[model samples]
Target chain A: MDAYFFPIIVTGAFAGIGIGLLGVFIVGMRMPFIGSCISHTAMVGAVYATLFNINPTLGALVLSMLGSAGVAFIPNNRKNLDANTGQAILLAFMMGLVFLAVGLEQDSRSEMLSLLWGNVLFAGWGTALTTGSLTVALMVFSLLFNKELKAILFSRSLAEATSMYTHLVYFLFLCFCGLILAVNLKAVGGLLIFSLLVCPAAAAYQICHGHKAVVLTSMLFGLLSTVIGFLMSYYLNLPTGACTVLVSTLIFAFTSFSRFVLNMND
Target chain B: MKNCVALSDILIKRGSHTILQIDQLTIHAGEFVGLLGPNGAGKTTFLKLCCGLIKPNRGNVRFQNQCISRIAPGRIAHFRKHIGYIPQQAEYHAHLPFTLREVVAMGRNALKPLFHALDKTDYEIVDSWIDKMGLADRGRQTFRSLSGGQQQKALIARAMVAEPQFLLLDEPGANLDPNWKKQLRETLDRLFNDCRITALLISHELDLIPSACQRLILLDQGRIVQDGPKAQVINSDFARQLFGRTITTPEKP
Candidate 1:
């Protein structure tokens, strides 16, 4: 069937959908920096996995999740040493990852570029299956836990008093974030996955007040970015991953500026 | 002091500095404990320790015959469900969108799981508490929209809505005028009169301590230098030494 590419495209769209789902939690917590940090850190992990001849996705997933949790654990209120500590730790870890990749044989460099830049045009049916399953699981979790998440986000101590465990909820959220991040590496690559996660949610948040509405609109925003980015890349013969990210960034900026103008008029 | 919350030879340290050293303390329930301490007297820290919000490096806070920690967090919620805590000069509650009724519903927050939507009956209970506080018309108003006096009253209603068995407020009355303070104290008296809700009000202002309170616990330099009935502690040498000034009760006006 010449239309065989349709299902594969649909599978890639699942990654687009995950963008909307994860975006709400990221923006709600006011922790978009956490998403940015984990994404680049996953790249380092991917390169390390390549050197060891391991499943690079697994390496990226575990390291990104741990890095997310570790950032949360750092005491930010002590003096002026808040995000500075996170920046230092992330820098050191990224350097270590680069060095490990340098130690690999020179012949593997071409293959490793696929993981870094993404080769969405060459995506196979198996990649589709992986992306599909991850997106489904995330959808189910978000639907079931939305109410509980809302209460905890209000106040940690108040949530604890109400018998809601903030630590457990936060940990599960990171794990879910890590999974989406790992799968998206196949499409947008690690360095650019953040736009898929942050931009759409931010744009949605600008217009929508309700949490569920924010999630839905963000998914729509993400899908629009993906389709437009894909067509632009195909027509211009540019790198698909970079095009997708740049388009999403433009959409985000456009929406944000419009909201700003509207607010000023009011 | 008899049937008291006693701390025998208590030692509290903060990174090698022993902040509080106490040989003994005896405070009975149902007494309005005006916990007065100068700045850095560890008043807030002591109150937090009593609530088990933070664990001491050593020594324990006890009530009656049982320790607070051995009690489950659920049971503590049940215990604190009855205690209304007013933090000192509460500054952060402004800008919230919730109506006074919704803010009061936060007291019931200690009741159950996050997903358990508070039903119609819970709203009615909160509505009634507002009516009881003489704010029936203003009940629909958001908490931040009210004057400082009204906000404190709304907060008190929030704290007492679960009909907490004990009420712990920290310097909440500092913002209001003398008349408003009296109104608040009267409201508290009426609110907790029938119930056995033990009240512990924290304030830096010594004169603001309600006359209805039978006992006064004077804290200075992280130690309880004076603990006695209002008349005994008022203008006593122990009170003056703890205060670092001669004790003259504020004019009634």
Candidate 2:
């Protein structure tokens, strides 16, 4: 049991790094709402999976990929809030279905809540392996595509002009996001997933400018927050998810202020 | 090599705005053309049409008798590989983290990725261009750290390092003080004379245009008001009405 729990803790922290990595892309794209949409859709998929007795993680992957595609193809017109609106509708629908599932289950309300917050203490060995492998794989692929991704971030049309298929890159990035979102499910929970995506990178951007620094600093901040949050949760016997979010928030705010001071000095 | 761009009766409209309405524009290779107009004149729009960055609602832009719209996107990049575009008031943020050298190296990105490690040859070329732009000492400086004129020089260097067959300059002299304007113009004139790069430059400040551009196209209200050889067009009655100045040839008397 201890063996299983220890690796799960390591995996949770590892997946936190993936979230941090994803956060860099989000920040680079200047689209924070993307994470929220992905998380909401992932949760809906989680619900579908639970109802059908399938891997909820796979369910999350399907919905998030769909969500990313939906956003990507949406007409550039402002009215197509389809991405965010889709998230809202999906979030409510999934919550209703999960509540219904909760009612039909023999498990107690607390047990269902445990799944919602993702009790890292009970994360199984299989969960550890799945999340760890996916995170590592995603990170490696992103590194390989860094230049193309950088070109995309700078100017999509220019990237396209240079024979880099900007759309294909975006599609691949979404696929990566979906898979990584699935992996992060155990640590962040589907509901609170976006916090891990936004906080660390946003804070890092407050201090850094270029993609290189942003990627490195954000990942560091993310790993720090995840490790610190888990330690706090372990020592204080408090809720883990809340602790993680709080720590990230504090770090982001602190970094923002420090950057402001540094800018003033310069 | 005689490279030429021909646009016949190119017409374009955006919503209620007629962005570009021209009869015929033939820019031959080894010629620098000045596109002059007031604000809101479709100068940049016309350049965009030629570069295929934006398509005209009517008519088409052609290079060497090949339609720009018909070119595949990948081929369009290859087509654009020979085109240099320096947008107006290019704001360089030092925050982008590219030094003067790296930014100029982006010119060769057609051959490699933006982040791929540059080779010694690439750096050598970058060094040559940096010196050309008088930015040799400032090669290591961040983009935003440079002064306004220096930044403009760097931006031009970045665009020109590719040694494009065609160069487009949009308000290349915009916002620069008179001294800087002259400096910029001298640099541009020197580049055009040396490389014989076919170029279309847009500027509202007609006086800033160098005499080396033998042809001029005047645009206002999104339509070509005047198009002809520089001497003929500048001395015409329309030029007087447009700018409220009597321009005459020295040989006229």
Candidate 3:
């Protein structure tokens, strides 16, 4: 258990911080469904890579980027499908590809299931290192684009008017989000990653007054969820990803309750 | 002979409808111009084109003697830093995650390089604008927590903190109550009279224009019907035809 602790801790920390940061953007954009879309897309990518005998995470990264680009390429006009419908179409198409890949791999079904549910407890040192590096890279990217991001988060038109290549910045953000989801897919599972991405940040948003506070609180909530959930799963012999998401859901519940109480008091 | 902005052979089409078409127009330096039009008359679209938020389907837009459409894509950001744009205020989410002061600071931040942090001068400028907008006490409050009037004042401060030479406003005074509107009017008056900023303001309210504008341009069905002194343009029969109502004579400033 001691020997395995390092990988587990690093995995939890990186996933918490990365997903928490991305959750801020995702929630702000009002695109909660996109996180689920990205995660599932990564799952499809991972299965394909396994079939080709390559590094599954790398495959997931490339395919998830394609998934994000797919969303971006959708025409946003009255003559085309709306953004939500476009995303839904991409998600459905990706799921079909995922099923086809699974059906072809007769002997690798269990291996794919492990990827789907995420066996974070057994992820190697390589996975941990990848997660940590991606997390650091994402943090630096956020810092570098801080001002442009604020303008964008406020309004895309305002950001463009200010002379920022808002479309480029927006595409880069979606790509980064896809990358984060891809790295975590092995440890957090496709079905459960949405909870990790949204619940902690949503909980933090209910209480924090400033962007810095909200981001910090979101990271803290994500970290708490991951650590506590890992311990509970280890001790009780439960599913790690499910335990992690349930912990996050519980935190969201607690935050909502506290917010209600505070509002009533006011 | 010097023009701050020039639009030539401009045409914009959305779907199948031609939203705007202009052969030639020039806005000189140190001018406060009011843009008026009926609903769907492409006033906002024209502003977007001037600000370089949208590219004209045909022809060219020149700003500060540089052809905006011809400038390298990478240089657009540098060009935009000298222009301030104030968008219409809507109900900003109550949990928007930025304070009024931080929002104002964004203006300065936009002008600075990515690797640079806000320094003393930036903070001073941000604080001065916050104070000027009467948002000093509310600076520390989340923008979403501020009242609608306070938020608009904060947004105006954010736009002005950069101290841009050119300003574009889109019905900024729409949501403000009478008192706040009066304060905004005074602020615009100072910006135009004292700061000598080149400004183009778009509004449906005829009364707000006369006090703040020296020149006026009226659009009808996507074409400029009148462009001249505010008094002449507003009182013209063409203006009446576009507005579908009589234009009241404005008192001289």
Candidate 4:
């Protein structure tokens, strides 16, 4: 086995579990753009950190956190500036900043682009540590607040009427998504990480009828996609992030097909 | 007896529009009241205030003699557990993954502690409500798969599983066919057999309001136009104007 094989396996586990569970919340709430918004903010932060010679991960983490909270805290009743609108505006602003940061540090231009496409083969133990901790924290939160999450997924207004602080719950959930994206920034890259957060969960949604089933199936799909895609990339000398995203997309297509066939029989 | 819900100088405004303004009102304990109003009459807004989901801009809302806003934020869940709120049926998304049983079980979520699984008693309560609502076979079916009336029945079961002291229904019968509407009326009547549990049902359909509600409260342009016995209020010109026709007695089964 190659010396990098162990790191690859660990990184796969980290990205799979963290993004998979977080995907359930994102998909259940029907907000796919949240993934894009958070990842783009992370990209801008990474570029800025590269220009300043700082740890890119820390900068990415802080900016993405702000972006997530900005989108989540938008009042639900606002017709002009809802969550989706806010996220789109933030994403556009971050994209502009990312380019500016890249241009400012012409010497580090490749370094900034590296964050966009990722180079997971050289991802150090720190990547594993960040992803591992984030996944664990998210799992604990999901366990403790299962009921509240279910209520919110069913209907935010009804949940609030039950005297639950649904707005707080929603904001915290988005923040966790941001944290996960930040932690996985190097392993999957900003552009492809959203695929990891969406495709596996979407495939799971086609086959699972219950909440618990959907979450578990999504994690299973994510892990399988990551491990297989990582292996394919290693043997073929291809990009790990693109391979992983493609695998997830294939899985979603398969599940959709199977669901269609099953429904036809009924 | 103290009022279950009391409002004083209540003003509900959205931007520049003062949607609802109530000088004073009291819902006594153990009374079934029907709220009648036209579109945009702020019936739903009033129910929201009563449930403490929204705070009035310039007044106090007291529940059981204690102001809702004054209670510690953490303790509000305890207060809310005693009230059942069923929003308009249209609020439910058809694609939600909940089954009939799961929907009903949500009623008990507020009473249980966080992270705790449903105990045997919780399941028993959930099952009882499903059965009582005539959804015995539909328990396993997804909420979206059921007919409109069945879905509404499941929602009612969800609200009642808590055995709330106050039940607030917001036009639960809208968008239903005549047959389904009759079934809904019967189901509501059966659920309110105990006079100890007060109820305030909001509806525009005169024929759909359950016969058990003794008092009728009418709202027009956000103010209470009439509040009295059902017979007296139903005969008024305001009632005719609200309904846009001569009011006839609703038929009894």
In angstroms, how far off is B55's CA in candidate 4? 1.3
lDDT score, residue A195, model 2?
Answer: 85
- Arrange candidates by TM-score, descending: 4, 3, 2, 1
Range of the 10 consecutive residues with the lowest summed lDDT in candidate 2 chain B: B89-98
lDDT (Cα, tens digit) per residue for candidate 1, span B1-253: 3342545556778778777767766557766677887778877777755555545666756755456544665465444443456655422324433466766766665554545666788788888888888888887666556877888888777776666655777777776887888777777667656565677777777766766676787787888877778778867887676667877665433
- lDDT per residue for candidate 2 within B1-253, as digits (tens), equals 4557888777787778677788777889898899887778878778777787776767768876678866666566657767777765522233444456766776665565434655788778878988999989988765546777887787678677667778888787777887787788788878888887888988877666876788888888888888889988888777777777776432210
Q: What is the TM-score of chain B alone in each candidate?
A: 0.86, 0.90, 0.91, 0.95
Model 2, position A80: C-alpha lDDT score: 41
Candidate 1 stretches greater than 4 Å from native = A1-23, A68-105, A110-119, A122-136, A161-164, A195-260, A264-266, B1-10, B19-32, B63-65, B70-109, B113-117, B123-163, B167-196, B201-221, B226-253
lDDT of 4 at B38: 90
Q: Estimate, for each residue in B1-253, the C-alpha lDDT of model 3 and write its tens digit.
A: 5799999999999779899999999998888999988878889889978888678889899998888976665777777888988887632343576878888898885677666778899999999889887778887888877776677677778888888878898887786676666667777776677778899999876755637687999987889988999879878998887777988844433
**lDDT tens readout by residue for model 4, B1-253:** 6699888999988899888899998999888889999988989889988988777888998888889855665667677888898888545555666677877888887777666767899999999889988899878777767888998898888888877888999999888998998898888777777435788999877887877777999998889999999999999989998998988756665
Per-candidate count of clashing residue pairs (backbone under 3 Å):
7, 0, 0, 0
Pairing residues by index, what is the TM-score of model 1?
A: 0.72
- Tell me what TM-score chain B of candidate 3 gets against the true chain B: 0.91
The model with the greater TM-score, 1 or 2, is 2
Q: Tell me the whole-model lDDT of each prediction, alpha carbons only.
A: 0.67, 0.71, 0.80, 0.81
Which stretches of model 2 miss by more than 4 angstroms? A47-54, A74-122, A161-164, A189-192, A206-211, A260-266, B15-17, B88-95, B113-117, B172-180, B205-212, B231-253
Taking the candidates in order, what DockQ does each have? 0.18, 0.21, 0.44, 0.46
